[model samples]
Target: MKILIVGNGARESALGVKLQEDKRISKIFFAKGNATTDNIGQNYFESDIVSLRNLAIQENIDLTIVGPEAPLVDGIVDDFRKHDLKIFGATARCAKLEGSKAYSKKFMQTYNIKTAKAQVFEAYHDAIAYVKNHDYPLVIKASGLAGGKGVVVCEDVLEANATIHKFMIDRIYGDAGIQLVIEDFLEGYEVSIIAFSNGQKLFPCIPAKDYKKAGKGETGANTGGMGSAAPSPEWTAENQIDFEKNILEPTIFGLQEKNLNFRGFIFFGLMVTKNGCYLLEYNMRLGDPETQVLMALLENNLVDTIESCLNGDDVELKFSDKKAVCLVICSGGYPQNYETGFEIKGTDKVEHSTLLFAGASREAKRIVTSGGRVLSLVATGDSFDEARDKVYADALPIHFDYAYYRDDIGKF
Candidate 1:
């Protein structure tokens, strides 16, 4: 079977590698994929939905798996369906779960899901006034998608006002910040739960901890994600059960009640505090660095899993028992200003691991930085410590100008 995967991040690279391992797949194509993906499949045209659809038709691609939320939000699945093409992703309507924070908050409230208290605002003055009236340390979020950097935690009125100004007036996140959701800050251990669904049954993957802060000791602005490790120490079976009962089940049932045909991956960003799991946010597609680690430990064929979902089959997803860790090496001034196109070196020395390219390209046979989050080094072992050590050791061989990464992922 010929397969087509969308997006050009490390997640897509990981998916491409896994799908290529399936003997049933005769040909594989990546839309706007990066350097590492080129080793796994035939890199095709850019990620334009129309061009991809045409290519799929011409090549007789059997399956198209979307790896990012942008095309999903732009209605790529809907467009593919129009041409009677089989694709794996939620429709634009179901993608509102991540596209609009206000809509998600309202859905949570309607379904009695455990989440932080929040208020949505359109006008800048109203949002600022609400922040001042509330108290200190609130989370200011862009109602629309902002590549995971839209949410800012304000420690005081000054910071809150500044964030509001940056998002609403200055338009820091483009039109995504036109409206905002100011939420009460909740403190706890954060974990990400990515699940597969077929509008009927839900299959949750091993919980992973994402290091959002740009620097060590969890300080600095949030980028896409600096690093991640699977089977987080805090994610006990009890906590998993609580999450399934309190968050996952309710969310699926709520979407069902609304008559929304929710399919594809559903990501739950949760803060597991003493008060139990509280919803932080939702992502429509797989998490980036987390996907790198999780896919490294996956023992089954990705094509089979996604095809089962698309076919509405009663499929049971499985994963390896080994622990995994992925470290994202980014440009020096990430989540802000940074330079790109600098030639990268040292990848040749990496052994017994996977290096999934995320913001990189081949410049005259040499890999170079291309985006904020550059590449991911993934490793797996019997224990988290072993995996962490292997990942860092492998990362040592890869270098580029202004390469920055967190040193304390999974240390807690």
Candidate 2:
């Protein structure tokens, strides 16, 4: 089967690698793939949804898998299906779960899903007034897509006012911050639970915990993700039962109740507290750094798993009895101002790890950093300590101008 993957990131590279495990896959095509993905499959350097649809038809692509939320939000799946092209992703309406925080919060409330109590606002004054009246450390979120940087934890009214101005007044994130959700902060460990759905049943992958902060010790602004580990130690069997009963089942039921035929990945961002697990947010596709490690632990053929879901069959996801860690190497001053085009070195020297590229591009005869989060160095072992040791050791030799990474990953 010929497959086409949309988006340019390490997640796409990891997906390409996993799909290659299925010998039935004859060829893989990537639309605007990054530097590493170019080595895995054909890179188109094109991201326009309609253009990709045309390319799929031209290539007679048997299946298309999306690796980012933007294309899904832009209705790429709808466009593909309109041309009788098979693609695995959520429809535009369903993608609203990730595209709009206000819409997602409302859906959660309407469906009786467990999440933080919050108020949505469209005006700056209303938001500021609400913040002033609320306590410190409130979570402020942009309503639309912000590439994982729109959410901020304001410690006081001063910071809250600044964030409000930046998001609503300054329009820092464009119209993505036109509206916002200010929810009461929940204290707990955050985890990602991703499930494959066929608009009916759900097949869940192993849980993962991602470090969102740009710096070590959880300080600084949130970027896409700095590092992550699979089979989160914070998750327990009891948590799984509670998650399925209250979070997973209700979510699938809600989608069906609302006539939302979502046939793709559903990422449940949860805050597991002493009380229980509370849904934080939903992502339409796989989580990044998390995907790098999850793919390493996945024992089943990725292509077959996706095909099973598309075929409306009972799908069982499998994982190895190992711990996987992913440490992202990023350009300095990331999630803000950062320079690119620096030649990266020592990638070929990495040992005992799987290198997945993101934010990198092939320049002439060399590969160079082209975005904030450059790439991920992943390793799997019998335990988190082993995985961490291997990944960190492998990351030592890789270098780029102003490259940095969080030192504490898989330590919690």
Report every candidate's CA lDDT: 0.87, 0.91
lDDT of 2 at 264: 92
Top lDDT hit: 2
Judged by whole-model lDDT over C-alpha atoms, candidate 2 comes out at: 0.91
Model 1 lDDT tens row, 49-168: 899999999999898888888899999999999999998888899899899999999999999899999999999999988988776678999999899999899999999999999999
Candidate RMSDs in order: 1.1, 0.9
Please identify model 2 stretches exceeding 4 Å from their true place.
none
* Runs with alpha carbons beyond 4 Å of true place in candidate 1: none
Task: State the lDDT at 10 in candidate 2.
Answer: 87
TM-score of 1: 0.98
